[model samples]
Target: MRQVIQLRTEQLGATARTTLSARSALAWALIELQRHEEAVAQLRGLLPLVLAAWGEHHEAANGVRLHLGTAHFASGRPARAEELTRVVLAVYPVMDGLRLRAWTLLASALSCLGRHREAADEYTALLNAASPVYGEDDRQLLWVRTDRLHQLAFLAEHDLVEQESRALLAGLADDDPLRAAISGAHAFVLNSAGHHAPAETIVRAALAHHDGADLCLGLARSLNGQGRHEEALRILTDARTRCRQSGDTEHVSLLHTLTARALLGLERLDDAETQARQAVEAARTHHGPTHHRSLEAATTLASVLAARGRHTDAREHLTHCAAAWRRQFGPHHPRTIATDAELAAVPKA
Candidate 1:
C-alpha cells in the first residue's frame, strides 16, 4: 500500500489522489506499527490534499481528520487529539461508524487529561446516541460502558462502578475478554472503598484469566490495604518487570504509587517517600498536574511527609490537593472528602 501510494503520488490528479492516497489506511498501519510520529507527519501532509480534493465537510476529509486525531493520541498528544476529534464531530456528526469513533476518541482524550467526570458523561452520551443504532447489547457498547466504569472508578464512584461492573460481567460470556476488565474494575472500586478482602478475591479471580498491569495493581492495592506489604511489593515488582519489558510506561506511575503505599505500611519511610515523589513527578509529567493519578500521587506523597513528621509540609500538600480534587471531582467525592479529612487531621507545626 505504501509503495502504491508512492507510485501514484506524482501521476494522479487531485480527485484520483484522494482515492489512491488511502490516507486513513496508511495512517492506521503506521499507528499499528507504533510509528506515531511518521503517521502524524504523513497525515498532516495528506489532510490539505484530502480537503482540497473532497472539500472540508466531505466524508473523506472528515475520515482523514479522525485518523489524524487517532495518530495524535497514539503519539501522546491527547489535547491535540481532542481538538481534532471535536472538529470532526462538529462537521461529521451522525455518520455510522465514524461518529462512534470520534466520540470514543474524544472521551478517551478527555479521560487521559483527567477530566473523568466529563469523560464519563461523554461516554454516557455516546452510549445513548449509539444504542439505537448498534443495539444495547452490542459489543462496542459494552466496551464503551467498560471505559465509563473506569472513569467512574477514578472519580471514586464506588457503588456505581461496582453495580455496573456486576451487571456488565453477568452479561458477558465466560470466555469474553471484557470479563477480566470488568472484574479488574470492580476490584479497583472495592479496594478504593476499603473492602480489601473482597477486592483481593475479585482481582485473584480475574488474574486467573488475564495477567495484566491493571489486575496486578488492583491485587497489590488489595494486599496493601490488608497490611500485607511484602506480598503487595512482590506483585508490584513482577508487574513492573512486565511493564519494563513491554515498554508500557502508562502504568509505571501507578505502580510507584502503590509500591509507596506498601513501603509506608512497612515503616520504610525513606523508601516510601522516594517512591511517592517519583510517582508524583512521573504522573504529573505524563498526565498533567491536575490529572486524577497525579493528584492521587500527590496525596500519597503528603501521607509520606506526614508519616515523617513533616506536618507543615504535609498540610500544605493536602491543602492544594484537596482543593484540586474538590474542584475536579466535587466536594462529595471520596477522594476530595478523604483529602480534606487528611488535611484536618494534620497536626500544627
Candidate 2:
C-alpha cells in the first residue's frame, strides 16, 4: 500500500493534482493502517491545496481538517487536534454526521489533554445532539456515555461514575460488545472507592467476554489493593506485553503504573522505581504532563522512592504532585486529598 501511494504520487503531473477527496481517502487509509506520520504529512500537504481550491469553510476543506485532527490526535498531539476540530465545528454549526465526528474528536482531544470537565461537557453536547437522530440506545451514544463516565472517574466523581455506569449497563445486552467497556468502567469506579473484592469480581466477569486492557487494568488494581502483588504483577506483565505489541501506548503507560505499584507492594523498591519512571515518561509523552495518569504515575514513583529511603526526593515529588492535583481537581477531590496525604507521610530528610 505504501508503494502504491508512492507510485500514485509520482504519477501526478505538476499541472495535475490528485482530487482532495481522493487524497483524503488515502490519508484516512494511512491512519487506519497506523502509519500516523505518513497520514499527518499527507493531510498537512493537502490542506493548503484544499483551501486554495475550495475555500476555508468548504465542506471538502473541513473534511480534510477533520481528518488532519484525527491524525494529530492519534499521533499524540491532542492540543493541535483539538484546535483543528474546533475550527471544523465552527464552520459547520448544524448537527450533521461530519459535525458529530468533529465533536467526538474534540472531546477525545480534550480528555487526553487532561481537560476532563470540558471533555465531559463536549460529550454531553454530543449526546444531546445525537440522541434525536440515533436514539438513546444507539451504540455510538452508549460509547459516548462510556467516555463521559471515564472522564467523571478521572475527576474523582466516583458516585456519578457508578450511577451512570449502572444505568448504562441496565440497557445493554449481555452479548453487546459495548458491555465489556461499560463493565470495565463500572469496575474502575468500584476499585476507586476501595471496594476491591467487588471490583475484582466485576472485572473478572468482563474479562470472560472481552480480554481488554481496561478490564485487565481494573483487575490488576483490585489485586494490588488486596496485597496480592504477585497476581497483579503477572496480569500487568501480560497486559503490558500485549499493549506494546499492539502499539497501545496509553494502555502501556497504565499497565506500567500498575505494575510499579504491584512491585512496590512486594517490596521490590528498585524494580518498582524503574517501572514507575518509565510509566511517568510514557504518560507524559502520550497523554501530556497534566493528565491524571501522569500524575498518578508520579505519585507511584514517589512512593517507591520513599520505600527506598529516599525521603527527600519523595517529599519533593509528592509536593509537586499534590499541588498539581489540587489545582486540577481541587483540594477535596480524592486525588488531591490522597496526594496531600502521601506528601504529609513522606519523612523529612
Candidate 3:
C-alpha cells in the first residue's frame, strides 16, 4: 500500500501542476487506513495545492480541511482538531451530514480538552439534531451516549449515568459484540451506586468474554467493594500484565493502586505500602503531580501508609495531597473535602 501510494504520488507530482484531487485521494486513503499522523503530514503538504486549485471556497478545498480536522483528532492533537473543526462547521452548511460529522469531531476534541460541560453540550446537540434525521435508536448514536455517560459519571450525576448506560445496553442484542462493554459500563454504575454484589456478577461475566481494560478494572473494584480482597489481587495481577503488553501505562498504574488497595484489605501492610508508593510515583511521573490520576494514586498510598501504622508518613502524604486537591478541585470540591477528612484523621506532631 505504501508503494502504491508513493507510485501514484510520483505520477501525479511529475506533472507541471499537481491536482489537489489526486493528492486528497492519497491523503484520504491514509486516513482510512488509520495512519493519522501520515495523513496530517500529507494534508499539510497538500495545503498550498488545495488552496491554489479550489481557491478556499470550492467544495474540494473544504473537504480537505474537514479531512485534516478528523486526522488531527485521530492523531490525539485535539487542540488542533478543535480549531480546524470549528472552521469547517462555521461554513459547512447546518443540518447536513458533513456538518454533523464536524460536530462529532468537535465534541471529541472538547472531551479530550477536559471541558466536560462543553463536551456534554456538544453531544446533546449532536444527538438532538441526529435523532430528527436518523431517529433515536440509530446505532450511530451509541458512541455519543457512551461518551455522555462518562461525562455524567465524572460529574457525580450517578442517576444519569445509570440511565444512559442502561439505555445503551438495551439497544444492543443479547449476544452483540458490544454487550460485554456495555455490561461492564453498567457494572461500573452499579458499583458506584453501592450494589457491589451485582456489580461483581456483571463484571465477572463480562470479563469471561470481553477482556477489556474497563471490565478488568471494574471486576477488581467490585471484588474490593465486596471485601473479596484476594480475588481482586489475583485479577489485578493479570490485568497489569495484559495492560502492560498493550502499552497502556495509565492502566498499569491503576492496577498498581488497585493492587495496593487489595493488599491493604488483606492486612499485607508492607506490600501494600510498596505497591501504593509505586503507583503514586508512576502516576506523578506520567500524569503530573497535580493531575487527577496522580491525586488518586497518592490517595491510595496515603491510605496504605496509615493502615500500615506509618502515621507520620501518612500525615505528610495526606497533607500534600490535600493541598493539591484544594488547588486543582477547590476547597468546596468533593475530592478536596474527602482529602481534608483523611488529613484530619492523622494525629498532629
On lDDT, the leading prediction is 1
TM-score of each: 0.92, 0.92, 0.75
Tens-place lDDT digits, model 1, residues 249-340 = 88989999999999999999999999999999889777778788899899999999999999999999999999999988898888898889
Q: Model 2, range 1-349, lDDT digits (tens) per residue? A: 5455445545664333456678889999999998988999999988877676566777878889999999989989999999999999888776777888899999999989988889999999899988998898877778889888888888878888888888988966676778788887788767777899999998888787787777888899999999999999889878887787776776877888999999999998888999999999989998998888888999999889989999999999999999989887789887788878888887787
Count of backbone clashes, every candidate in sequence: 0, 0, 0
- For model 1, the superposed segments whose C-alpha errors exceed 4 Å read 1-15, 18-20
Off by over 4 Å in 3: 1-39, 55-76, 94-98, 244-250, 267-295, 305-337
Q: lDDT scores for all predictions?
A: 0.88, 0.85, 0.75
Model 2 TM-score (2 dp): 0.92
Clashing pairs in 1: none
Q: Clashing pairs in model 3?
A: none
Ranking by lDDT: 1, 2, 3
Q: Give lDDT tens digits, candidate 3, residues 1-349.
A: 5455445555676461346687888998999898989999999877656655445565666678878988987675777888988877676555666677778888777765655567778889889878888787766677667766665554446677677767678756656656766676677667756788988888777666677777888899899989999899888878877887886765666778788889999999899889888988876555446555577789989988788777899999898889977775568655678789988987766
